[model samples]
Target: MSFASHHNASEKGEFDKPSRKKPMFPVNDRLRAYLKHHGREVKLPVAYRDLQRFTYSVPLKDKDGKDSLWETVVYDLKEWEFIREGLVKIYAILKTEGDLTFTKHLDVARIDYCAFGNSQPFRIRIVNKFNDNYDHYYIKIADASRVYGLELEHILSPNRITFLTHQQTLVEEHIPGIPGDIFIKTYLQDKETNRIRLAKEFVKFNERCFVRLLGDMRSYNFVVDITPDIEDFQYRIRAIDFDQQSYEGRKNLYLPQFFKENYPLVALTLEYLNKDSIEQYQTEERTMMAFRLASARYRMKELLDIMGKDNISTPEKIGQLSKELSDYHLKNPGLLRCHSMGQLVKQHLKVCLRKNLLLIPRLQSRFED
Candidate 1:
């Protein structure tokens, strides 16, 4: 399980031949070795907890090559920030040979400072390191910055603190938002109007996310603010945690199913896929028609930008959405075996409107005389 061994040997257990093989990026291994060699140089306490057991940190250097207290902490997702008092943090998966996925880094860290935004909430500050290991993998801070911009624009970025890179560590701004479940039970259901407002926002949000290609959305990753504003006494919905976002490619629009149990709208969306490949656009537009049921304009472009795509051509969007819907059903028979996604969507709304009591009867009535 040593880094050197893994890097030197192929998966088949034979040593890689230089003539036919390319030297893999020495990112993780180099950092580990560097940290092992120079732990004392940066005055990193030897007895401290192994926050990143497999990770390594080295002192950052300036143009003049002088060691600075600042250093990048190279570690795996297995060991990011774990404990947060009230802030959310962002991190990148320093992918070497595959598509990079973004995620939140949850670790116990020393808080530096905080700020308050009336619209969003709390913002916390944290230290930043150079993250040279990430640089070695070509996962530059610029990519992270772009992704951050996308999240903010889409309103899918965590309301947490902003993450900034210093010489050796990352400084982050903290964000504060109620957990999804709590927000649902406490705020969403507090009043009929609140629930309706949330549902409207939810539908708009999903449609927007799908058309724009910001897959990997699910419940609990977001929160709703039911607390009425000082002037209007109305509720609001805000999305958070936009780490896993991409536009050029997508497994499916409903990729967030891993987190969500099942829903008719999502099932219908899946059913529209053609061959389990990228979703077709028309199918997505159709699914959106069912999802929105009433709204005509869905703001597809805005969402696409947040998803890092400049435009979703009418033809391309229709094509991808259709393909995705067709393929999704083939991949998930359970979704297709049951009622059509359209029917289920209708039932869900009825259930919501009837206060979750008439759901079964309504579903039975669809088939019964």
Candidate 2:
């Protein structure tokens, strides 16, 4: 199949409306203090504004000469020299805690700007002169919602995220995996692909996003990581873009299985797993998330307190989601009391964990018998 067909499969059509543009939420003092205490705040030599000094840019193309929606930005010699030094120092800070021992051998390969998407991030490619090895990182405006999303992913998800926040800039280490769309188009047809394992992971991933209230996890926003085991391969679905963390009003947006582009994987779930198996996977994921919350009780409490008081979404959106959640949970009084996205998340987790805890004794007795 042509790439066009694959692209068409992943793109949301008229019926599958795209998510609305979410405004960037500023990081307030309380959130900043929390980030500082958690070692996520660091001073950077270059702010995001400094990268805007590019004099010209050329359209970056893929191997097939298709426009990549990225521009390879060019800077004047003097400006390049200054920015290059700062970026190198920033990389050192991100990768080696500012050791700078290997800075001399590194060179800035290319700086590409993506105009699309909420963050409008600048992608930096760094190359090693000696070994010709290369890596990439992203610099974006520091939206408070995205920062909170990254922090939650770090603490709760099976995957660990590395990111640093400066004044108005956020730096994130690149996550390595096949884009979910590409994986569905290409790897799904491979002979050795484990459809059942992939479906199970997607189920767990869906549960994780819903429990955490992370939204807009369309196929393109996530990546599928494949690891080889002794007997077979394993798959993990990780969210790469976190721009919609608890910001949207629709509850379905937080559940990946609801997206049209994810229909192939959803189909796989139906073919491989029965209803009992699906519920079992969901419970397993919820139990794990509850354990993570208990493990990081103090940190989670502080973050939620700050986020509950912050205005990350419109008041109308907060009201809509609170009502939806309350209705879904049979008008739980705790959910009805939530006035902010953060409070809604906290209440949802509380009820979910309480329900799961009640199931534990019955589950344990069955196992013992």
Candidate 3:
């Protein structure tokens, strides 16, 4: 399954510039109420703003001596003590539903800040005093689009996310997996790798992103969760960054396989899967998403209601996406009625899943004959 035939492996240039710099959309009252109803709202002792008071910082490196793009921040002694305690409490809330009994044995091992992202998140490492076990969590400024992305991932995707939001701070449990870029660089070329399985997973992952209108799934923005099975291994690609969820104007931005950094996986798909198989996987993904939508119908409707009224993107971007979708699905007039990204996504799900569901019975009948 060598992909040497796919010579154009540098498609990253096509996506050189996304539509625009994403403005941080505020969490309005309606969205806040939805979060509260869903139990995603909580009171945190420390906010994202409080973590910015670090007195000094030193660059952090990986085991191989490469700069990790993170800095280990240090605070004044008095401020350190207070922030450390608050961090422990925050971890408790994230991991144990605000149970304070476990705080005594936990210590804040380190606080690292990432200066690269839009959120500038602080990564907190919590270590157990008795056994020295450690885990990581993140604190970032709460953006409405990110929150919506997290909620959609929680409800629609197979992965379950644990996060809590306060006024301006968001605490999230660290999703554990090997980053996609690192995996592709190190493991994709290995002889024993399951190319078919990996390619299948990537197809489904691509479909999931497009169906939900989650944008900007560059190689680094996602991770590959590899689980060893009895006979082989299973790989699931999950998006770790959600900053571009439903915000981009270009329709292809929502599809990860279009990104040049992901060309290797795209090449693998071309080598391992046929056109029919790819469409089958995409339909399978849409069917599962439709089922999730059915189960969470009320909550999904409420969330979309709020999102429809919110201004998460510019009017021009919304108009462009709506028109693109309308033209893409020329047979379905529902797309032309969409006035916002949220509405467009809702209609997309309805039209795609309905078509797939209808095709199933006809295909079954053909097989029976």
Candidate 4:
């Protein structure tokens, strides 16, 4: 199907789910250098390929005994010992800067592999032998698109991202939150749940994703982090999956409000937030993201330069997105000239956050190198 048709459907208040599988883009030399310069490249004791030695697997079930779309993988005895010891060390590297003094008391509790996505990550559960407490981390193949998404999330979003790349392996710390699908199913109508606050957060999240050109934020792709407030409650929606970053051509793909999976959240937004209030939250988020851009302008420039020269998407998608974005920002000539997803993102940032950039005093266009 053509992207124009997809855009038309999106305009008619419908959404088409992104492709079932997005081909993995390898981490090129330039991105590898960027990761190295930014301390995101680390040699780990275990790699993604090593963990594929699982001998057998059992379907993993949730607390309600429903299929969790994951499998508990078992390995040979010797291989298990090797992976357990290595994974414990990896956990330390991710959480405690490679500290091993607590290693003797820690053990790999289980290894669960999910074959559902492009990365097909192995979820590692690490437990402290003494306390019976466990923590989780992930190991996956390092794809360039995901790396760009992670780097952008670290720089632009309010949250801090911690991960490392080693050759074809990627390691990430667990992000704790209720999955958006589960949150909506279980918490949307709860008596104590603050609908207004959540609706406000959804507005901000929508702005964040659109401004940065991040895509595929269906309900399950993101999470809800709730915190206690003195008088009420606060909500923060965070994107958990980065597989679709900068890959789609349709502009609506980057906006969470258009996805059918997010219709409930959209209903909350429309029900609780007036048009002006929604605009206020969008501007507020863009202003904060602009501040973040200023703070990390140098690093963002480096990444954008590398990304502009990378081939993370097809030529057709690139051309379609360029035309769509150019149409969206007719006043900004740069969008018309964007030849790659990275360039579109760079210009889109300027178009969306120009007001906040002006407030930063001499911060505009400093990203040009």
Candidate 5:
């Protein structure tokens, strides 16, 4: 936790963009086994390679006619027949746990391919036949680093993620929220928007990402989930993209407040929150993460054990991040000794949350009472 305070002096930290497109690391036998144990491993009718058979694609555009970085893919008649049915089933698996009872009326409306990011995900739009309603889910080539990021988010954060893997194919339910960049652009300045609550959420969100070693939370990488509560509203910042989790060499890359794209949110935090209030929010987030860790300690231990033994990052990047973290924590020799990214993640978790973990009561209680 001592090291987390260093960037507070500047109110923003500037760092280079991601060094390169991260190579997809295979989900090893151990990770697969863990997924099976947790029921994340399932047999899917389609694989990542199957979707690449599209005949052609048309560039997608937003309402303002701007490039959306996605292309609507068109498949051959036969391929489309196979893919459409399987996709409908995959949607069922994601939303209803493999139940085919309701999939009879469901159909694949469209498939959009995005070549902009690491995973190169295919976004599937599933529509119900009875009405015009539609929903989306993603299919990606499962990278171990991204899987680790998703699992950590599911366990350590206030939100739960639903995803499944079959060999190299990963299916993820679409997380619903206003993209952070959109929210910041359109909603942040609304008179009805709550600046103080948004600022608090950003602070907490920043803490969560750094403590867990997730990175690259630029405004567009996450979403702002606004919920109506009491007489006002509640804001929750959630990381929707996890491609950079635990892979970057730079320590500051893990903190959202440092990214220039997030400067406006950082300015809001600075304007609405004093130093003490910032500390209080950070502490509160860490405490909540501590409780989540406590509740899932055994499962987390298993995941980290598999991760620590795996090679998800290059030795150079691992060493670079390790040394940076070691220096940040007063040159603690333990961080320097960490040989893997997983080791660094585990160590960082302990270092940042040690005090809160100590203070956590043995008997957890619900807030309802």
Candidate 6:
């Protein structure tokens, strides 16, 4: 299947205020209390400062001729809720409405340091100008979000993602960490050793994501956190982007199938640079890694069937797509090489086995009247 096309546009003017439809979830007080009490309870000892009620007097108007203003209360968290536990910021949008969106001025790795990197966060606002209609209003807003999400996801590591809110023009949590591209390009140098390690992790992560039916793994939607002083750049990864994550059955967007049929080939090509017969060092543990990757693919298929029954593409289409994807990989051997022909066959067999195993359970589970 062809990848969808994307368009990037210049950033828009600053929002004067949020729209009325975008009320700060009335749970504001309770959320803060939870953060206050639970923030200290968590292993991560970062402080959560409530910045709500802070006047964000951007120019905002409403459907009514009456004047309305956008207001926001934000919070800054000094570290990740997950790994690395370094300096980070999470802003809670107290309120917003109309065309509210955000754009990044820096890559994920340098996001936390945007202030230091001479990059300013870009804000896009939809105005209630008499000239624009409702349809035009939404079109501008959605296009802006798409560009922001895709571009941002590109700069993040495999496991890192960013959080955003349009209701209050919120760009929550500027995470401080390494970009995924940098990690892939620099740290994952020993072709076979790191390739297999990364593949296993990718499979596992994709499986979990598919089970939940999350859609669209954009390249730059995440950020990686490295230990303050690493001996050799060893660091844990956490996924940050959740904007595209949700239980949308209508799309049949399973995590596993997408990777196997779409992502793996491209991802492997990018990671391995089409290296041939690279040594699988002791650290590689090829067989075990392969198993994990296969398992992830299997889990993904099962998850998809569970989440997307009526919405899934026809069996014929699914088979056609799988074959097409496999053929695509084989045709571009130089760009998508497996260690050897034998290894390629073995890997594909594993994928098939995993896919079948997942399908059997799903079919049986559903057929059981």
Taking all chains together, each candidate's TM-score versus the true structure is: 0.33, 0.92, 0.92, 0.95, 0.94, 0.30
For model 4, which pairs clash?
none
Q: Report the alpha-carbon TM-score of model 5 versus the true structure.
A: 0.94
Off by over 4 Å in 1: 1-163, 166-172, 227-233, 247-369
* Among all candidates shown, the one with the greatest TM-score: 4
How much lDDT does candidate 2 score? 0.85
Q: What ordering of candidates by TM-score runs from best to worst?
A: 4, 5, 3, 2, 1, 6
Q: What does candidate 6 score on TM?
A: 0.30
**lDDT for each residue of candidate 3 in 1-369, tens digit (9 for 90 to 100):** 122323343532544346546778889999999999998999999989989999999999999999999999999998988899999999998888889997999999999999887778999999999999999999998998899899889888989999999998888889999999999999999887899999999989988988889998989999999999978999999999988888987777787877778888988999899878888888788888867766686788889888888878887888888777777777467787788888877777766666554455443342221
Q: Across residues 1-369, which tens digit of lDDT does each residue of candidate 1 receive?
A: 012222233234442111111111111322323223422112211111232243555555656798533454454565443423112222221121112232232332332111111111112233223332211111112123233333333332212223332223222222345656555445543444433334334444454444333444545545555556654344333445433333212234333332332132233333333232222332333343333322211232222223222221233333443344436435433222322222222222222223222233433343221
**What TM value does model 4 have?**
0.95
The local lDDT score (0 to 100) that residue 261 gets in candidate 3 is 85
Summarize candidate 4's per-residue lDDT along 209-249 as a digit string, tens digits.
98998999999989999999998899999998998899998
Model 6 ranges off by over 4 Å:
1-176, 185-193, 224-236, 247-369
Misplaced by over 4 Å in model 5 are 1-14, 361-369
Which residue ranges in model 4 land beyond 4 Å of their true spot?
A: 1-13, 364-369
Candidate 2, clashing residue pairs?
A: none
What lDDT is obtained when candidate 3 is compared to the true structure? 0.84
Clash statistics: count for each candidate: 52, 0, 1, 0, 0, 34
Identify the superior model by lDDT, candidate 2 or candidate 6.
Answer: 2
Please list all clashing residue pairs in model 3, or write none if there are none.
Answer: 12-260
